[model samples]
Target: MIDRVWTTNEKFKKRSEQNIVARSSLPWNHSCGSKSFAATMSTKAEIPHFVDFFKESHWSKKKDDWLDHKCMEKHVELENLRTMCSQPDAIPMSQEEMSISVLGKKSGYLRGYGVGRKPSNTNTTSRENDGEMIILREELSSLKELNETQQNQLVRQQQQLEAQNEQIAIQQRTLEKFQAALLRCRLLSSDQCGDDSLEGC
Candidate 1:
């Protein structure tokens, strides 16, 4: 009788150990598996829709449209310039010569009547005009370089903004999923507490 009792006790202990192991390996609650499945399906369904919406969205198309318009305008300007340069009487001046002719010219009376001025004064004025032209050219070149740098910076900033927006959206989705999971967990625990039974779960 003692040996039989010992054997039965050992069998009970083994069965209890196996049950514990199985329970540990299983999901925390029966609804957990279903909830996960639902979450996965929800995410999968949303992803394709989100991608399609993003692809077809106005913001996505706006950049491309703006770029196309700019390119077209540039092409038209270049064509106009070429046509102008191809004319018979058109003098194709170098950029430097053009700048000097445009910026070096005096305005008002100085341009109209230069003969009345003294020779020394005329020489000084000419030197002053040349210095102003050089300064203007340098300023124009620096401004052009600054404009290019600003354009590059704008492009980089736009890219960074897009990347950050995408990241924020992903984080928002993840946070929503986590909130839903927490809510479900709380509901499950509440039900378990009220019932005080594992059978319903």
Candidate 2:
């Protein structure tokens, strides 16, 4: 789900950079070149929007330094988006759709450097931060479900123990009754309570 709050640079200052390479990975998969990548997403999301997230300018980076390399080229904006951003004072973009493990360190280095490089924040955004938060949030939800399961198991075990204890109490009472009958029979003499009279005793 896309969020307007995330569309703002407030949530992703670094992502809002001018030079991004993976802009084509935007959920609104516009570029035909990214068809294979778009295939990995929902078909409904592939309907291209009027604007792309990172403005692409064709450029090159130094070898090894190719990661996170920046271009001096001026950033071009979508005429409509530029108008909206100017009036609202915010960049209009979709929420990042990628997920990363939130429990670990963030990784935002390029191979992601800019040519026409708009800092891209898409499903392809650095998984360490925004995506990681999503993954971690899901993990938190799962943990809560597991906790509920454990609690239910404990309750069932308690019930079983209670049932067992009740049965034990009944057995104890039966044993005491049998012992009392034998004791009463012992108090009788041989003539007072012979073998046949023992039944009546």
Candidate 3:
């Protein structure tokens, strides 16, 4: 937006240097009287359309921004200039002087875009987009590594649980074997005691 407005203003200034209004007759330069009358026109007569010619020729796409603060501010400046030019004691100002007085502002314009500041042209916007893409790719790579680490941790935990289960199974089998041997020992002791009682009888 800013770039467009700046380009337009620059074009207008070049046009002014190469004979103003781009041509003798423009959409905004229609005189109230004939060409002969324009030759002898007074400052009062020209004041009404003082800023219209340049504005109409160079405004950006957003024409409705004519009511914006910056536009209004410049309009006021131009209006004051026109009024001053109509005064009896007013001195004639050069083109450069007129621009400095009315359009010398650091930034802002009729189309609500920056006028004299650094322009956000195509190259600048492209560079910004490239930077954003690089950052996004870095973030995505970081996330992928984190997911792989979590998966590895889960696999290690599962292996540990399986090993613990095998150990418990071995312990249960050993306990069952010891219980069988103890039962056999008790049977043998009972048999021995019966035989001794018979012998005594």
Candidate 4:
């Protein structure tokens, strides 16, 4: 849904950029009715059909959703009818069933087959379904890309952690060597104090 909105917004922006509404209107030039010079049109006014197009899209979706809901209701009704007819207490339907009967050809066909068909434009539903499929595929691709990016980030962090660990080990070994050297120097100094200590005693 967000992708659809963003794409629609981008198309609106492009239409505005192309200045499709006005063939020869210059952007910087504007004229007021001789009273106010401050009433210049903003760039938004350049796209004349933007609002209408958006509204039409909204209405189209609403209408389609309504039809879809009605169709689904019919399907549910048919299913219920079928289930009720299957019960032993229910009367058996004739070969030429009533219009409301689940086994009736007309009801079944309309409830099931009519879902993908549009009377005004046969290709509209097909195109819409294809577009939705494309969008889903694109979303999946984007998620995969994001996952790959995170994996790369994790690998880099691991490398950095390993490098830091190696540096810490080097620092610890140097500290151990310095402590040993200090201890050896103190022992040598103590050994050299023998003559002075005897004189004092």
Q: Rate the local accuracy (lDDT) of all candidates.
A: 0.49, 0.42, 0.53, 0.47
lDDT of 1 by residue, 18-47 (tens): 977966873222222333323433444332
When sorted by lDDT, best at the front, the candidate numbers are 3, 1, 4, 2
TM values, all candidates: 0.35, 0.32, 0.34, 0.35
* Stretches of candidate 1 exceeding 4 Å from the true structure: 1-131, 197-201
Candidate that beats the other on TM-score, 2 or 3, i.e. the better one? 3
lDDT of 4 by residue, 138-183 (tens): 7766776887899999999999999999999999999999999999
Question: Where is the poorest 10-residue window by lDDT in model 2?
Answer: 96-105
Residue-level lDDT for 33 in candidate 2: 43
Query: Candidate 1: minimum summed lDDT over ten consecutive residues — where?
Result: 49-58
Given candidate 3, what's the lDDT at residue 134? Answer: 66
Candidate 2 residue-wise lDDT, 1-201, digit = tens: 245555665646456442254464432222224343234222434433222322221222223221222221212223444454355323333322111111112355222121222333452354446667567657766776887899999999999999999999999999999999888777765556577777776
After superposition, candidate 3 runs with Cα above 4 Å error: 1-128
Candidate 2 regions with alpha-carbon error over 4 angstroms:
1-128, 189-201
lDDT score, residue 13, model 1?
69
